[model samples]
Structure formats: structure tokens, C-alpha cells
Target: MSEPVDPAPRGGGVALCLPLDDEQRLDASARRHGVRVVARCSGASELAARIPALRPDAVVAAAQPQYLDAALVAACDEHGAKLVVVAITRDEQRLAAELGVIDTLAEPFEWDAQLEPAPGGPAPAAAADEPVAATPARGEVIAVWGPAGAPGRTSIAVALAAELAGRGGVVGLADADTHAAAIAPSLGLLDEAPGFAAACRLAGHDALTRDEFERVAEWVPLSRGGMSVLTGIGSASRWPELTAERVTATITAARAWVSTLVLDTAASLEHDEEISSDLHAPRRNAAALAAVRAADRVILVGAADAIGLTRLVRARLELLEHVPPERVIVVVNKVRASAIGVNPEAQVRQSLARFAGIDDPVLIPWDPRGFDAALLAGRPLGEAVPRSAARAALGALVDERILESAATRPGRRGFFTRERRLA
Candidate 1:
């Protein structure tokens, strides 16, 4: 590999979130390095609010309030800015880099020499003979998505999450639907409680730790097992709170601690067309999009009826644009003999094979009575009616597919590398 020529002499902009002493040193260095200090924040809280408006090219801060949290890093990622954390000691420097900062520097260092790499450039390589940082184990993120028309997305997602919770290990269920969210009410959770929305805010400020996330995530009481849930907004108009960056941070942090994460997302994938010309305009489907993009597997749910099947096929086609086909699991919900004649499951499979080339799709039988009872009680289908046809079918899906996939998944390890304690 060869070094590329440096670009034009335009001064790069930076945002500072550092102590008084460190902040002053960074300022002096910025002047010496021909870089502009666009914004100065006393801490992470102020930094999170200012970074977006100033949109600096880089950010430098203390590692504690700096790189450890996903929110600040995600904000930097969205603004296309670089991050460099100041570490007072060698151990702190290693920890900072492990926490996913763009780069690390010891105090009393030369700023011009350290800022040599261009924005978006790869991190500086480790020494030839030195050991490299270990890659952390990443948990599985399963996103349940579908088009409009109540295709039973939430039911399948909740049922799947409940089942997985019983299998062992930690599981996180997130309601990421920006439009008309119902997870909280569906699960009998308190509508007034702060959940995913609050977690996103904390994540935005880089203040959400693993323990803090658990507090924001509501714990659901499953008859057979239990799982942690991050409920959706109380109202539809609050969609702006579930921005792509915040959603990504929440999910990323959840993955760090849990073995599996099930997400219930919105029906649409369309962005704001009226403001399409402006890249910063609010996207209504951002939560759904972020969930799908971050997922290891996407469970595509659709109704088994004619109109529902047509929408399912189209939705699958659209979903293919975002995730790989192999990673998608098709689930036909509310199957009934009257809708598609005798052997409804077989018919649905044939249709999918013909139109989308998807074989072995999971078909859930319609069970209005059981489903209605579960909905009224605000409990999972399995707990409300364990032997219900739909519930049994969903259980089979968990046994044959979801659980097996998560169990056999390779590289189950801690997300953060082992770091020496600070003296």
C-alpha cells in the first residue's frame, strides 16, 4: 500500500469535550496544526447536543465521557466526523482504543503529527511486532419486519422473544416502530414508563452504560420465562426521537450484553420524499431501517390471504434491497383453509417458491379466539393459550429455527476486550 497525496489546505473543524487543562492544550494544538475548533463543550451532555449543529470534522475528549458510550460514537458516525480520545496513561490509551474510539493519544503529545491521517481513513496500524486488539463477540440481532395492514409483526416478534428468553441467556426485545407503536400496550407495559425513547436519549449523550440500559429496558414477566424489553414511544408524533443514530446506538449497546435481540419495527421503508433534497430531513422509517441494517437475521412476516400475500411478496422484494436474501426468514401469518383452500400451508409455500423462490416458509394458523384473549389480557400467546394452533406453530418455529440459529452461532464471547484496571 502507498500513501496518497494530501488534499487541499482547507482547515479541518473540530469539537472539544475535555477538561480545562486538556481543552486548552487541544486548542493551542489546533492553531498550530491549522485546524479550526468549531465548538467547545464542557462535557458529554453538552457535546452530544452541540456536535450535530456544529457538525465538526473531528471530536477530541476524555475517554470516560468520550468513546465508551455508543451514542457519542454514533453521532460522530452520522456527522462523518473522526474521534480521538486523550488518555493520561498507557493503560487508559489501550482501553480507549478498545472502546472503539477512532484513535488515542497520550497527554503532552504533538497534535499536528497525531492528526496526520485524513478523516475516514483507517486507524493507524499497530507496530509490526506488537499484538493487536482482540475482536469482541457480537450477539445476534433479529428484526421482524413487514409492510402495512397488520401482518401480525408484533405478535410474532413478542412470541419469538418470549420463547428465546426461556431457552437461556439474556434476550432484549425492542419496539423500534416509529409509526403507531403498540409494543408497550400489547405487552401490558406501563404506557407512561420511559423505555427505548429514554434509552436513545441517554445513548445520544454517551451516558448509557450496560446497567443504565437495563433500567430503561422494562422487564416482562413470562409465564415460562422472562426477557428485557425496550418499549416504543407513547405516541406516533414522537417519531423524531427514534432517529437512525439513536436507534443504532440503543441496539448496539443492547447487543453488547445480550445474546439475542428481537426488534419489532415499522411497516414502511419509505423516506421523506418532500424533503428528499435535504439529507438531514427527518425520516419516518429510520427506526425500521436501522433495525434491519443492524440485524443478523430478518424475520419477514405477512398475512396468508390473497391481498396480504401480494403485499408480502412485494415487501420481500423491497427488503432484499437492504438485507441479503439468505439472512431473511419468511413467516406467513394467519393462515386458514378458507383463505387459500385445503392444505393452506402447502399453497402458501408453493406461492412463495414460485414468486420469491422461498421454500419452507413458516405458516401460522389463524386463531382469533386465542389471539383476542391474549390481546385482551396483554400477555404472550403461549402464556394465554399455550396449546393454541398459532402459538404452537410459533413455538415450533423457535425450536426448529430461531433457537438453533442462536445456539449454533459462532464466536459467542464478551463484546469488550479485557482491560487492565486503572491504578
Candidate 2:
């Protein structure tokens, strides 16, 4: 196990923000360790406002049930504060990690025994000198695509956003599939305001701004408990103005306002030749490609069947030219154990490994019953069927892998980097 970090005197004092018992324990521990414990907040909101004023060297949040939310985590990021979360649940530890909580302590931890900084060291400087090089701020775009069949690209995109949002960060979900946009109906999103399409149009003319874009977003309520959604085009005819550059800028602006920006792209990456004949054909594939290039992580979804797998393999080869394999997360969807052949997971994995050389593809089992229920109830998998095996599998992927990856990747500038730059 890694050694416990010593309390660093990064100029600012330590602030203990936790519940009553944990706060008392931490206060005693800090006093014994020769580190000053400043203030303690009972609630996350209170702590959020107090953080900037107190400017604590480090904030120790006693990871109680109530304190585990995105708002608190986002507040920490906003203030560029170091956070240590003490978790009561293993699941909470996973969730905390997803939210970028640096140091986590399991429950029943002896505060006094572990609170001190190591003998040789103070903590690393609270803030870096060079403004810690931010990740490619909102410039990376990802367009999720699959063939016409039940390739489950939309499902993967929705789940991916839900996971990112659950990490206590802002996420934007854009439906860019003009031909057969299903994000709204799939998530039971009722607002048909064409906000994303409008944003795309405004961006085309360079009129998109952080404020304006937020005003345009429809704020589709989430079913799985956290984050909001932004729906897309009402019809394919509206695709004329949603060009690649405009879409890219719009998404960039959205990412500026949110931590994760998820685009539900068109199934076909090929240019619409019929529309190409027109002056305003709106090169769809180019727009999709631009989004793919901008995304920090790209999830490519494909059906488990033979034809769907074939299309995915082909798409994988094409995507490799643009994105690194590491950035591309492949999901084999609609796998059914009772289906025609061998176990769906093994078969799909074997096929991808054999042909596409893509190993360890994230397999989403076929859950038509659960999916239909969610669709009918207008909820995400977590809400409509929280206990469903499909939901459990999705949670494992989202809560475990995607969110964890987002947290550990240093240099990520947060969603509002562009706004910060402009300010």
C-alpha cells in the first residue's frame, strides 16, 4: 500500500469539512499532527462557498452518504483545491475516485494514526506554477457511429454520458444523427425545441457563446439520478446548417460549460451523396469525424451479430487513421447468451480479437426487456431497472472504467476551461 501523505504546508492551512464525528476525529488528528485544522462545514454547499474564503491547504471531506455528489466535487475543481474523501462504502470509494477525489480512506480509519504527513515531506505545492497544462480543452470531438442495424451506438453514448455525469461533473449529450435521431425518444426526452440544431446554426455564423449556448440547451432531465441532457435535431432536413465546423464549435462551447460532452452521431459516416448534390448537403461524415477528433474518449458501438461486427471491424480500421486505439473504446452490444451460437460475449470477443485485433471490447448484453421498459418509462437503465443485469453491467463500465479514467488523467482543465481563458 502507498504510504500516507504528510500534511503539506502549501502556504494555506488545512480545513476539515466533514460530519460531526468525523470532523471531531479529524480535528484531533490535525492538532496532534501539528497541522492546523481551520473550519468545518456540515453540508457540501456550505463548504463550497467557504472553500474560496478559507483557502485551505487541503479539505478533508468525511465521505459520508450525503456528501457524495457532483456539486461538491465540481466546487473543489473550481477552487483548484486538493480533496481527501473518507468513504463509508466501497462503492462510494469507486464513486469518489470517479469524481477525482485524490486521497481516499476506507471507513473505520484511525484518523490520528494516519493524519500526519510523512517524516521527510510536506505535501506537494498546492498549485503548480504554469497553470497545469490543461487537456485539449473542448477541442476534441467524438461522433459515435455504427451501421444501420441494431448497433447500439445511441445506448452506448447515453450510458457513457450518464457515467461521466455521475462523477459529479457537467456533461452535455448532443444528438447529431439527422437521418434517424433517437436520443430524445430513447431517453424519454420530451422537449423538442431543436436547441442543438440552433446552436449548430448560430455556430455556423460564429455567434455561439457560453451563455448563448446554455440558453439554447433544452436541459433534458436525467433518469439515472444525475446530470442533464441536450437533445438534437427534430428532422434530417434541419441538417443543412449543422456543418462539421459549426457542430465542432458548438460542442466545444458545450464542453466549455460541462465536463463531458457526448455526441450521439449518425449511424452512417459516409457523406450523404443525395444531399451532396445540393449546395447545402452539410457533409455529415466530415462533421462526425471532427467530433471524433475532439473527444477525449471515443466509444464505438457495434451489434454482436455477424454483419454488425463486420461493419464495426471496418469502421475500426478507418477510425484508427484518425484516433489512437487507446482513445477508442469499443462496445459490442446486444449480446444474448440464448442467441443463435456460442456465448455472445466470448464469440464477440473472439471475433474482434481475430479480425479487428481489438481485444477487451466492452460487452453490453442484450437486454431488450429492460431496454423496452426504460424506453416506455422514459428513464435510464439505472432508474427504470436499477437491479437489471444490464444496468449492473453498464454501471460497472461507467462507474468503474470511464469515470476512473477521466479522474486520473492529469492536465484535464475541467469543462469551463474556455470560459476561464476568455475571462
Candidate 3:
């Protein structure tokens, strides 16, 4: 065996997201490390935005909660660049591994170390026999979607969030609908700051801290404590701001902010812009698409009427194109004999099963009065009319869905774990 000497990395180009002082230190240490700093930036978002132009061989980013996240890793992979993260804590190192980094280095970095191991990359994990680290759990995201016509997506999402909040840890309700945004007005929230859009912006900059997220979100009081609310945009024109990248970043930032997240999304699922328009243009439905894809469970709500049933059938077929059928929780709302003919529950069930191949759909009986009270009170039906049959139905639906998943879902250390105090 011959001893190899002068091990330079695959390429000299490397992107660095560090302070100016550290940037200078890296410049001084590059020669010893056998790598060149191609570009130096202060934020992961900035580093990502420059990847295409810089075309670096590797990215070295600070392992802060916001800066070195899934979005940044994804951005690097999309550009075919390896990531070498600088982590200071056991949790951050765990996060780096979970994100599949090519290399991990301790902060303050031993740059003078003989650049050991592989030709270009730094060493991997610590020496063997180090105790395994447990990563904290992230909140599960649930997206409530429906077809074009009003099928009560917002109503269901609001109630679901409230119900989840009452059960335990902090819950988040995000109004992610691009067209006809309504969570703010429905909840009597002032929408003065446009919570969700602001959060998206902060996430893009890798500045979405726990305090910042809480500041942007309005607290909605429920029967048991309350949930944080990220009101929808004041108008649909701002859809482009919620890009797929930013949406992904926001969801990652939110993992520690709450135990459960409920997103009320738009109806349209068309992403045909790539074929019809410029490939690089901002997508209008990117927010909804991102939410649906990121969700642990998607609740497809359908108004139990003749016309609504037709739309649901078509929408479910389209939704299946994006997510697996098992990942979706089919829900038929406002079920009543007057709208869907005799035995509305049976009719709705049979229609869904026959047309969409959907079995075991939850049918919530019509309780207009309960919903009306909630609307007037600027609250969820569960909080406004806890004893209503509709609320009870929603409770059972959530219990079944969450419990079923909990039985099989992989467990992680509790960062935001809440006591199971179901109301």
C-alpha cells in the first residue's frame, strides 16, 4: 500500500456561511485544510441563493437551528454540492446527521488539524462508542384541503387545531389558502401583520426564531388554553412570496414551535406552469402544494351534497396524484338528508367508495347552529359549542386518526411533547 500525500478536496470552491471574523479565520486556515473558500455569506438562505452562481464543491454552514435546516440541505443537494456543517451541540450534530451531511466539524473548528480522512471532506461522526443522541420530536402537520366550491376546509382546520390544542401541547393553525384567504376574517383576527407571510419571509432569511414565530402568530384562546394562529394573507396577490423553498423552511422552523400544525389550504392543485410558462417563474399554488406534501396527514373535506360529491370525487382523484390515499383522511361535512337525499351518511359513503375507491370516510352530521355560533364568536366549533354533536364527531375523527398513527409512527425525544390531557 502506498501512502497518499497532498490530499486536496475534489474542488477548491467552497461556500461558507459564517461571521466575518470566522470568514477571515477560514481564509487563514484554507491552505492547511486543503480547500478554498469560494464565497462567504452570513445566512444559509443567502448561501443557497448563491449556489448556482458560485457552483461550489461544498457548503460549510453554522449549525444554528434556523440556518442549517432541511431547506438549506435540500438546496445544496439540488445543486449537486456536498454539505459540511459546523455543529456545537449534540442536538445540532444529530440534526446534521439526520439531514445527511457529508461531514461535521465542531464549532470554533480545529482548522489546523491535519485535514485527516477522505481526500476532500472532513471526518464524519465522533469516534465510535459515543452514546447515540436522541433528536427532539417535531410537530405533525395536517393539511385540510377541499375542492373549488366551499366545502368547509377552514372550518374543519380551525376546529381540528383547537381540539389538538386542548388535548395537550401548543397547536398551530396556519391559513395557507392563497385564493380567497379567510381564516383571519373568520376568526375576527385583525390580520394587521399577515402572520404567515411574515413567517415565510423570516424563514427565507434563516431568522425565524421561536420568539419571532410567536410574535408573528396571534394567540387564539380555546376552551383549554389556546393555539397560535398564522393568519392568511390579506389578499391572494401575495401568493408568489410563499415559495416552495420558504414554505419548507417555515415548516422546519415550526417543528419546535408547536406540537401539531393545521394548515387550511387552497383548492386548486394544478402545477402546470412549468409546461405553460417559464420554468423558473414563481408558482402560484406552491404554498398549497408544499403544505400538502409536508403534511403527516391530509384531511380531504367534502360537502355532503350532490354537487359537492361530484367535486370531491374529481378532487380526490387529483389529490391521489400528489399523495398516497392512505395518507389522506377523507371527511364529508354538513351531511344531511335534505341535501344528499335519504340517509345522507349512507349515500355519501356509497358515493365515495364507488367513485373514488375511498372507504371509511368520516361523516359529520349537519349542525349549522353550532357552526354559526362559532363563526359569530370568532372561534372553532369545538371551543364554541363543545357539547354539539358535530364537535363530538370531530373529536372522534381526530382521536382515531392520531391514535392509529401514534401506534406505528417512530418515536423521538420529546422537544414539544405534551401531556395526554384530552378534553
Candidate 4:
């Protein structure tokens, strides 16, 4: 159907996808360094279109939304061209870097350095053909995520963390929700410290060691069956500070600090740049995406009612686009017969299977009294109301899914796969 374009040889061909002024400024450099501007494109689609014909060795574009996205990065990768971003601001630079651009130039550019060969010259391109598998983490990072209707993510996360901590190992609950963060208030902890954000900041600076991580994560009292807790920004406006890079780095470093980590993430997963063009703004949903992507498994929660289940089905489709189906463990919260009619669990399961193609989902029954009591007591369901149906349900999930036999789990790792869920 489509014609095949032969791969462009490595040369001084650079495609420019910049603003008019920037194009004028860099135009002179084309003549000086024997660099040729093979094509001029506007956005990602146009750039991709030109790639087949021009066969550029590199693409130079401003770090604005119009010039950058996953599509643009993919085009460069497919065409064997280096995507070099022209960034002026720190946010722009971070955005470009996160987009997987290895080469970048600040505004008021240079062609001599750009055209210069490496000190040892280029190695054989065949060296890059090697394939590698990532090592499994020594510890487990569980992300408790749900849609915006509030399907009880914090409660599930706290209960799950408590269940893991009950095994007499280090555990942590991190509030990665940037919107309406209530982990501190839910657990009766002080909220002024900006715990997780501070950790992200330290992670951004490469200063978050295990000790620093523990220090930033406040420890609960033994009376409450202690586990380390990292609070979130109490206000939603502070989301930008939790950049994807920092959140990812913090999550990576967390493997050594705790045996299990539970993260309560925000509902939004939209990549902001996809919606609106900007001068390289940080994504509002970066923390949630980063946590979900970084986690060993994601606990996708949704309320049992019609609206919640509807949202859940939509979330499942979006989530599966990012992670494999095996990485997801669906949970229907507040499962009551009154909400979803005669057979709530069956209805929920049927809906999921029909709409989202999910066969098995963990169903936690409605237990308002137990949750209210636990909330008032400022403790997890496991500690405050051990006999709660919700607590028992989540406990069972943690036990069966997370605390499997040691033989299957083996040693602490950064990445691994046995039969795991596949078994």
C-alpha cells in the first residue's frame, strides 16, 4: 500500500521545525558548517511527512508543544534522526529530555559544535542492535489509582500498606495525588512539610538517599502499627512541582528503602501537551502517570455504581494503552446491592467484561461504618477496624497477590519475572 523510503545516510542534513525568527537566526549556520536544512516542517505530522523524503540526520525544533510530543520522538526514532530540541527555559529543557531527546541546543545556536564529530568518532551502528531485559525490583511498588469520582484510593492504599507492614517489614504509603490530597488528614499527620514534593525536589537534585528518603517520609507511631508515610500537596495548584522525571527517580530510588511501597495517585492521566500548545509546560498528570508507570502493579479502583463502573471501563482502556493487562488488578469499591441492583458483583463483572474485557476483579464490599470509624480514628482499616469487610477484602488481595510464597518471590531486585501472575 505504502512506498518504502530507504534509510538516509548519516550526513549534515538537519530538518528545521522552529519559529520563524529562530529559523532566520540558525539559517546562516547552515552555510558555515556544511549543514544542510533538508526540509522545513511545522508540526509533528508535517515533520514525519518530510522525514521520508529529506532523510535528515537530525531534527531541530523549539521545545514547544507544536514541535514536540511522543509522535515526534517516534518519527525521529523510525527515521534514524537525532531529535535536537532548542530550549530556552528550564521547564523546556526538562520536557525535551523527558521526551527522550539526547541532543539539545540552547537558543542563539552554534553550527560548528553541532557538526563536530565525537572524540572517538562514531562506532558501528550494529552495536545498538543488542536487546536487554530489565532486572526486577528488590521491593514492590504498588500504585493505587482510580478515576475522579473518588473510588476510595487513599483507603485502599492505606489498608494495603498496613497489610504489608503487618508482615514485619518496612512499608510506605505515598500520596501522589496532586488534587485534593487527603493522606495527611486521613492519617492525622501534619501537612505543612510537603513530604513527597520535598522528596521529588531532592530526587531532582540527585540528593535523595535511603536515609534522606526515610527522613522525608514521616514515620507513624507504633500505636497505629507504624509504616513510613509520605504526604502530598494539600492543594491542587502545586502539581507542577512533581515533574515526571523527579517522580520517576524517586520511585526508582524507593526500591532499596522499603519492602513495599503504596502510592495513592491522582485520577487524571491526560498528557497536557496533547490538548494545548504551550512553551513547554509541565504536565498536571505527571505524578500519576509516573507512579503508575513505575509501579510493579497498579490497583485500579472504581466504585460499584453505574457512573463509577462506566468511568472504570474508560480508565481501563486508557491504562492498558500504557501498561500491560497483567500489571493491572481491578478493584470495585463500595459494592452494594442497592447501588447496582440485585446482583452487584455479577453486574460489575459483566459490565467490565463487556466494556473493558476484564474477567476477574477484586470486589470489596460496602463497609461505611468501618470506614467512618477508621477515618475518625485517623488510622487504616486494618488498625482501627480490623474486622471491617473492606479491610479483610484488601488484606486478602495483598496476601494472595503481593505476599506470595518466598520461593516465587526470591531475593530483592530492582526488576524479575517468574510465572508471577502468568503462573
Candidate 5:
């Protein structure tokens, strides 16, 4: 059991999790230093859970490993609370740094200037809470985007990455799906600690370097070329960590290291930030927009049926507003005769050309068995089912579209023609 000690003098907040006598001493020392004792607890576990809710400007926890854990630091950082470990020994000071703690306060409860919190201490914030500059778009970045429906956005992205990697060039696959990331499971990646989230965290602190970015990337070997993946957040709730600035920085760093970069972005592109009108408020779709704006090319994926075609048309229009039509490659997935009652591929191509002005769009055949086998095996389509129709179509897409785009890299012009632009 822990005790709550909210003493007098409502001023800058200071949370304390120390022994009983130590708590009294620290409380008195804080008051002497003119700092308000906002919260006090006996156990570190209690403080860890309470820090975000309590919203103290600074926390002073004993240097013991139990009191100073990574979870406490993460919680404090998430809520904008600065954690200062109370270290009385050299080992404790080193431990604090090893645990990724921001700062450390020496024992004996001294009147240190760092202990004093700034005016208007932090308030309790809910747990849920950039565009690339024109500087030499380092490497060719391909962003994959689609509308609300599943539309096989991630599947297409994974297959595209595998194909790009098969070209024998260094490829970086980034799963930037903030809403619902499936790249880890889709590729059978057992990533308990996703690299994308870690990179984002480092980027937020301006500590992410090219080396660190590469270090976080997990290698996924392809048949021909080698590919590395920066998996998305562990869960959708952790999207706040993937800020627009961080996403851009991470992508830039990834480009610095890889020959080709493939980004799998979120489904929506609504400018929620405009509605909020607050820069601090987290925009859920910022990651998607940032990836699209920063990319050298964008892959627009949509399902093949009537409803899917309608959504794709509307989604394509919306996408065109942010991305130039020339750079967007339309892909229709799951094309089957049963769904459209005709030559599915031709119908999809005809509908896209007639309705969305997307001619020669790549149509992927529905191969449930092949897709399921690869998914269950946690391997790529090329490795799991090379004979799959969808795999063959994806390989064609790479050979015809991506490779050609790469060849004419400098000052590259988009593929959308004048008629399609007008239509």
C-alpha cells in the first residue's frame, strides 16, 4: 500500500515516491525549496500508474531498480512529466542513464535549481493523445495509401516491398499505419518491440541518428534483393508517439541508409489538424499525409467490385488533392469473375479508366489459397507461393512501374497523361 501526500502551498508540482521518513524529509525539503508536494507515494509501482493521472511537473523516485523502471519513465514522458531519479551512489547514477532516464537528482534532498518546476506546472493529460523539406529527396520513397475499406493496402505494400527488394537493391519497408498496423503479422514478423515506434520516440527527442535508424530496422531477406522493415507501433493506442515530425525524420534517415524506401501509410487523409486548430493536438492521419507528401511515388490501392470502385474513385479524388496524379499508381486488388460477372481484370481496368481516369491500372487476381498459405507461414508470397496469380501480377507491377520509375530518377515526370488529368 502507498500513501498520498498532497501538502500545502499550491505551486509547482513535485511527485515523491520514497520511504516514510525519506518522504517526510523530501516533503519538507521541497517546501523549503518553495516547491509544492503535489503527489507522494510509498511504492514505485503505485507512482508509475499515478504519475500520468496526477500530472506532476517533476517526479523524484528512489534510485532503486524497482522504483526507477522504464515504465515509469515512459509514463512520465508520455504525459510530459520529467522524471528525476534520486541517486545517492555512483552505480545508481549509471543505472539511471542505462534505463534511459532524462535526469537524476542526488540524494540528501538538496535545494537544487533543477528541482524547481517552471511556472504553470503540467496538467493531467489523457493517455491517448511534418512535411519533408525539399532538400534532395534522398532516395526514391514509395508511399502506399487507400480508403477506409481494407482494400489490401498492407498486403499490396508487403508484396511491393518484396518485389522491390527482389531487384537486388537495398530496400527499406516502413509500416506507418497509425490507425491499424498489420505489417508485423502480415509478414510474420515476431516484433514484440516495434522499431517504428522506437524510432519515432528517438525522433521526438531529436536523438534518432542514421545509425540508430538502421539499428532499429529488422532485416527481411527476399529472393533477390535484401529488405529491412521498420515495423509500426505495437498497438493503435500508441499512435501519439508517431508524430509528423518524427515520421518525416525517420523516413529521411531510412532513405539515407537504403537504396529504395517503401512506406505503408494509414487509410484516411482528412486534415484533422485544421479542425482542431491546435498544433499540440494529435492528428490521427498526419502520418499518412506526411508519408504521401514526402514520397517520390504513391501507390493508390483499392478493392475491385462496384462498392470498391465507388470508394476508390472518391478516394483517388481526395488523394489527388495532396499528391499529384502523375505520381500515383492505382492498384485494384481481389479481381475475380464471380465478383464482377465478367473478365474481372478487364472490367477493373475499364471502370478505372472510365470513372477515375486511371488507365492501365494493375489488377491483382484473388488467390485465397496462396494468400492464406503465405499468411499462415509468415513468409512472403514469392517464398510461400511463387505460382500465385497475385504474386505474378505484383512482380509485373514492379518490373513495369517501379523499376521504370527508378531508371528515370532525376527530375522524374509523373505518368498521368493530359487527358487523364482532365478526365
Candidate 6:
């Protein structure tokens, strides 16, 4: 008889609470490295209760100010758990240190590298030579981005989320457009609720934990289709400390609870100097760029008309430098079939291919009636008009691409391996 195979020995388990959607992917990766993971409460009090019972070897709190608060750090230390904080900006780094967190990870991290132990930390043990379990990459992050001049970034983003939600798996839409605060009104989300602004506040405080985030995020249901919406900040001025670190944390936490994360970003790509100097320059909009870089895929929105197409071509060139070509998707919005001249799809494709060399752009048909009605009612397109052409197009994309691709990615790496620098 064949000998029985022994189970792989798992290293000490770690408890993770983060604000970013990518936390799920990261957690899966950590398990691949033979480490066990324990998901704690989304609130601080519950987390405090679970800590002693779980006796985690380490604690990873992403971009939540409360997690790094002096009291929490002291609690972790008292319990003999190492704490690692993932920050988005230099200020967060300083704040983390002040709170006694010595380890950190930045956003847009390479999955493998980010999971590695902090500098000077001991390396993780190797996994059993057995094949790693297949796990999906984090949910798809679709960005509806267009240049200034009403290219319909927000409209497309909202509609796309509605379509995806209609198809079922949990979905979340975030308004990360710092320049334009339209998500609340566009979706008719009540400003009285603690939405994106509250999350940002938690992120800035250095005392926020994953549990805290879950408490503050508001869930807007889609009556027509599928998914939920996490509203964005009401104004740019309110997010002075809205660093990339905080955004990553918030997304990570959201991912643990949701299946899809859709971000509506500002048109501009310029970064604020005061926010943090760590970001690379010439790519101005650090926050939006960070979102794009972290996303599994990006959907570029362009107007159907002539000038819109022109801006799309130009923006494509700029994006090429930051994201891979295969990952960048071009979308032409407000297309009209009857509006004379050459075929709208063919002409737009030909123009983009000729100028920007991009092929196969997704074209969303004109649906002014459906869109206007939904906007006025403060509901998703799926809820307002389930049969709209625009909604169908979005569904096709989500089913064929987003969900399928995420389901097939390689399983996460389990063993943590920190970088080894040679003298």
C-alpha cells in the first residue's frame, strides 16, 4: 500500500485587518507560504477580544490609523505579536513609527515581495514541495477615466457597477475622483451617511483598523441589478491626508467583504506635493495612478465624438508608460449608430488605431434617456432601466473578462520570503 502523505506544516498564523480590497489576494498569498491566517473582527473592540483567543504570531493592519494607535500597538506587543503596518505616504510611515510599528509595506506592491518579511526580519520557512492551491487574484478593479470636459467618466463607472451587480457576485463602487465629487449625487447617495469621507478620516488618524472601516462604509443597494456602492469624498479639501496608503488599506478591507471593486478616478493625474513626496513625479495624479497600478485591469473612458476620441488617444500614450498595454482597456462612450458619417465603432477604432495604435475598443451605445432617468432618481442603471443597451454591454464585459480572468489567475504563493540584500 502507498504510504499516507503528511500534511504540510503551517507556520504560526497571522491575523490581518486592512482597508484595501487587495487584502484577500495578499492573504491567499501568505497562506501559500505555509502560514495560517485568522480574520479578526472589523471593529476594534471585537478585534481586541479575538486577539487573545487566536494568539496570532503577527498582525498586519493596512493603512488604518486606529490600528497603529499607541494603545493598539501596546496591546499587540503585550500579546507577543509582531505588528506590520502598510502605509501609503511618508507621513504614515512616521506616524506608524511613533505608534511603535516598525515594519511597513507600500501600495501597488508586487504580491510576492510585499508578503516577504520586513527588512532584517527572519525569513519564512519553505512550503511543502506539493503543488500550491489555486486561488483567485483579488477582485477586478475597473476605473472609468476620461479627460476633462464631460467625457462621462462617472456615468460609465456607475452604469458598469450596476451591470456587474446585476450579474450577481458582490460588487463595490468607490468614488476616488478627488478632483470631481460627483459619485454621491450621481448615485443619489445620501451625504448624511458616513461614506468615503469617513474612511478617509479613519485612514488619516493612524488609529483605524479593518474593523473600524467596516463600521463606517455605507452600502448602497442596486435595485435594478447587482452590487453595492461605497461613496467617495464630497469635496477634495476634506481629504488632505488621503494618501495612497490609506486608499490601499480601505480597498483591502473592502475586498475581504466584497467581490468586485470599481473606482471612479479624477481626470487629472497630478499628485499633491503636500500629500507625500515619495511618489514618482511626471505622473502627477499619484492617487489615481496608484489605483490604476493596483487594479487588476483599467477601463479607459472616452467620449464618442471627435474631441473625446482625440483625448483618449493622448491619454492612452500617457497611461502606456505606467500600466501594461494588455491590461489597459479603451472604452468609447455615448456612441450613436444613426449619427451619419462612417460607422461609429469602425471610425472610432480606425482613428484610435491610426493615431494611438490601440485595437478593439469597447463602445457603449448612447442611452441618454436611461441615464438621465437613473441620475434624477438617484439609483443605478440596473435598478432604473434593467434593459438598457449600455447595461448589456457592461454585463458582457464583466462576464467575459473581469470575473473569468480573476477566477483563473495562479494560486497565491504561501511561504513568505523577504528580500535578501548582499553587502
Best by TM-score: 2
How do the residues 85-105 of candidate 2 rate in per-residue lDDT, one tens digit apiece?
Answer: 665443454455445452344
Candidate 4 residue spans exceeding 4 A from truth = 1-137, 222-225, 406-423
Error of 2 at 387 (Å): 2.2
lDDT of 4: 0.72
- C-alpha lDDT (0 to 100) for residue 362 of candidate 1: 91
Q: List lDDT for all candidates, in order.
A: 0.71, 0.62, 0.72, 0.72, 0.71, 0.60
1-423 per-residue lDDT for model 6 (tens digits): 111111321234566666545456655575455545565334334455555555555556654664446655655555655555565453454455344332344333334543545457665432223322212234456666767778788888887776665443345687887666688898766655536656756765654564564456555654422344567666566554456776666666565444467888888765466576755432335557767777767889888887778888888877777788888878888887555246877877787888888778888888999889889888877678878888788777766666554222221112233331100
Q: How many residue pairs clash (N, CA or C atoms closer than 3 angstroms) in each of the candidate models, in the order given?
A: 0, 13, 0, 10, 0, 37
RMSD of each: 17.2, 9.6, 16.2, 20.4, 22.7, 13.8
Tens digits of per-residue lDDT, candidate 1, 292-370, equal 9899999999999999999999999999999998889999999999999999988999999999788879999999998
TM-score of each: 0.64, 0.69, 0.64, 0.63, 0.63, 0.60
lDDT of 5 by residue, 297-415 (tens): 99988888888889999998999899888899988888899988777877888877887677778889988898888889877787789989899999889878877653222111221
Q: Least lDDT summed over 10 consecutive residues: which range in candidate 4?
A: 414-423
Superposed Cα RMSD, model 3 = 16.2
Question: Lowest summed lDDT over 10 consecutive residues: which window, candidate 5?
Answer: 414-423
| Cα lDDT for residue 372, candidate 3 | 97
Q: Which window of ten consecutive residues has the lowest lDDT sum in model 6? A: 1-10
Q: What lDDT does model 2 reach?
A: 0.62
Of the two candidates 1 and 5, the one with more favorable TM-score, higher being better, is 1
